[model samples]
Target: MTNFRIWAVGCIASFFLLGVSLAFISMNDQTQTTSGTDDLYEEIISNKAKYEKPAENAVIDKVWKKTPGIEGRAVDVQASYNKMKKDGVFNEKMLVYKRVKPDISLEDLPSSPIYRGHPDKNMVALLINVSWGEEYIPDMVKIFSKYHVKATFFIDGAFASKHKELVQMIEDEGHTIGSHGYLHKDMAQMSENQAEINMEKANEVLYALTNKKVKWLAPPSGSFTMNTVIAADKLGMETILWTVDTIDWKQPTKQVLLQRVLGKVHNGATILMHPTQVTVDSLPELIEQLKKNYRIGSVPTLLSENR
Candidate 1:
């Protein structure tokens, strides 16, 4: 009878183990099925949300309007236009803003430096100040062309006046030319008439050299005044500021200069660099890293695209 009781106890234990195993298997199966269903439901919800979101109809409308000289309007165009108008295109204000008074002072210009961090896939523009080292102009052009990046060069009228051929070469290479002023004077201390004279002198030289209107201006020593801006604008110029100051004028080490520019560049940034040996040494690396981290575009392109 004791042996029989032992056998019966063993059978009961076996049965209990089997029951636990079966329960675990059932739970796991149910969990897997639930997880799969949840995944599918999430995908469906995401797609639904994507479809329900508003379309960029305004952008489409603008593109259509700007596309000039289309023959007859097609059904597709009308549909697209109507959809855009419904999507808040027609509701936008058509009023134009009055021109901002050109009252920025030379003192208002950035003297120390301006940089959030060197561009890392966020830098928008490079503001190049071209003066000195005219012998290296061709090499500079080649370097820019090799990297397929265009830069704005603030040419000193004195330099530009002497190197009309080089000035034309700069323009022929599809780069924007701007006035660095006739003699690189501080615009803040100058009278309004003097400022105007300075700008006119630079404009005359640049215009004569490149046969292109000088539309941008960068003050020497980053100095300027309300009168300066007014003078520039009166002569059809726009004031530009640097987001990254190279301090190449200070003759910093190439590594140090590279670090400063690489560490502080960001989108909508304007880099201030001079045509110096240190800058020349850093150019290859700067261009490579900038291309890797951000989209390198000409200053004019950046302004036009952003504006």
Candidate 2:
């Protein structure tokens, strides 16, 4: 009887010990699985962070130093930096590394006397008249480069002749060059033949310098007649006009200029501006605002997308 009791007690103790050991093993396995899942989650988030935000050593600040409004001017860099941080969209680095290829098949567009680009596209063209403000061009170019923006620069023949190096620089930067008439004269007041002479003269200079044919013409002061359109068509250039005018030429305050642009801008809008102080001041912010809804590009880019 004593041997039987002892045997039963030993069996019960062994079973309890075995059960405890099994439970411990199961708990350890679950902990390892949970730990592995957490590690994977952290890795995924780290990988995403690598691409979503701009690198800490990005060259944007250096580029801004070369830009027009901020260069050689007393600008609060920290304030601008703080503002950019607050505005998440502006904080994103401009993805200018993407090279836009020209679509050779889109040569048949601008089939109208007055071209404002395709209204259906979610894009905007910046038309910068370069007859005056030679000092501002470099900064403007830098700003455009910083934003990876390609704008259309309409060169007056006189301006081109005096500033050939600047014109070459603009072309080399991959921006489109167009004619703003030979002498910034009103083409509307001239006869068809006279208009042709002005157009041809400007076209000749631009071609001589850039080796790229002028495909668009923005008449000075946006003044043009039927004769101007005929002359442009003869030269195989489209008569380009603006959908939005910044009126920066009048030297409006930065706040007012910004408000005017933001209030009037829409998809497929062509903004007319000159290389003025106001324009330089307003450009960076303007580009950021427009980028939210519209792809800011050259007129040719808009035309190609539409085609």
Candidate 3:
């Protein structure tokens, strides 16, 4: 009975020792796994830190150095680059290093009379018809001078011949002189030959007075046929029409004239008026109001800027 009792005690001690050894082995394996996981996590963090910041900085520096021109446009280019980078599409094809020329030319344009200057420019032109009202021109000139604005005056050939001094005065004041057709007749009613004759007649007189070639023609009463355009084109002149007409010739009140102009005026507007009392009186206010929203200049000046 004593020997059996001793054998039971020995078996119990061996079982406890085996259990402790297994527990220690299990803990060591678990510790080794945790340490391996920690090393891999630290390596991942270190690699990200080494590469991420410099990659972002490289992208920004490359985009900024390639963009040109005004700072505003450069900012736009950078924003586009940043967006492209976010999409993983940033490449050399996105850069613009030079000014691109337009693919269109004058011949590519539609064959219609120019009713306004370039639509891209925030500008308006005043086209004054000088068919009759010679007496009021000086006052109009004074008002234009006061506002520091230049206009294009389409002069009747007969009126221009009779009033060369006024034509010279208009020219000296830095205003443009265009043909209003000879005899102030409707160009649409005339033959091509007659149209050419009339345009040449007006051109001769204006050239004699201003010593500058006439480059624009406004058909009398805004009446023109295709022949009129052809005739003007043959003479190296472009036909111009008004986008906004004041109709001061109908002798409207100053308020009516002002309303007609202000209501329709916009960027690239070619405003038509005549040398009349109402137009002369309304000129100052019209110019002052338009200057707030538009750059007032001659047709050529505004058109060239747009090109």
Query: Clash totals for all models, in order?
Result: 17, 0, 0
> Against the correct fold, how does model 2 do in TM-score?
0.64
Candidate achieving the largest TM-score: 3
lDDT of each: 0.66, 0.74, 0.76
What is the C-alpha lDDT profile of model 2 across 134-235, one tens digit per residue? 999998999999999999999998899999999998999999999998889988899989999999999999999999888889999989887887788888
Candidate 2 residues lying further than 4 Å off, grouped into runs, are: 1-111
What's the TM for model 1?
0.62
Tens-digit lDDT string for candidate 1 (1-307): 9999999999999999999999999999999866755554444334333223121111112211110011111123233333443333321132112222223322233222222222222446766676577877777788888888888888989988778888888899998888898777888899878988988898888888777888878888778766776777667566766667889879999899999988987765678887777887888899998887687766665544121
TM-score, each model? 0.62, 0.64, 0.67
Worst 10 residues of 2 by lDDT: 64-73
lDDT of 3 at 223: 92
In model 1, state the lDDT of residue 276.
76
Candidate 2, after superposition: displacement of residue 27 in Å? 49
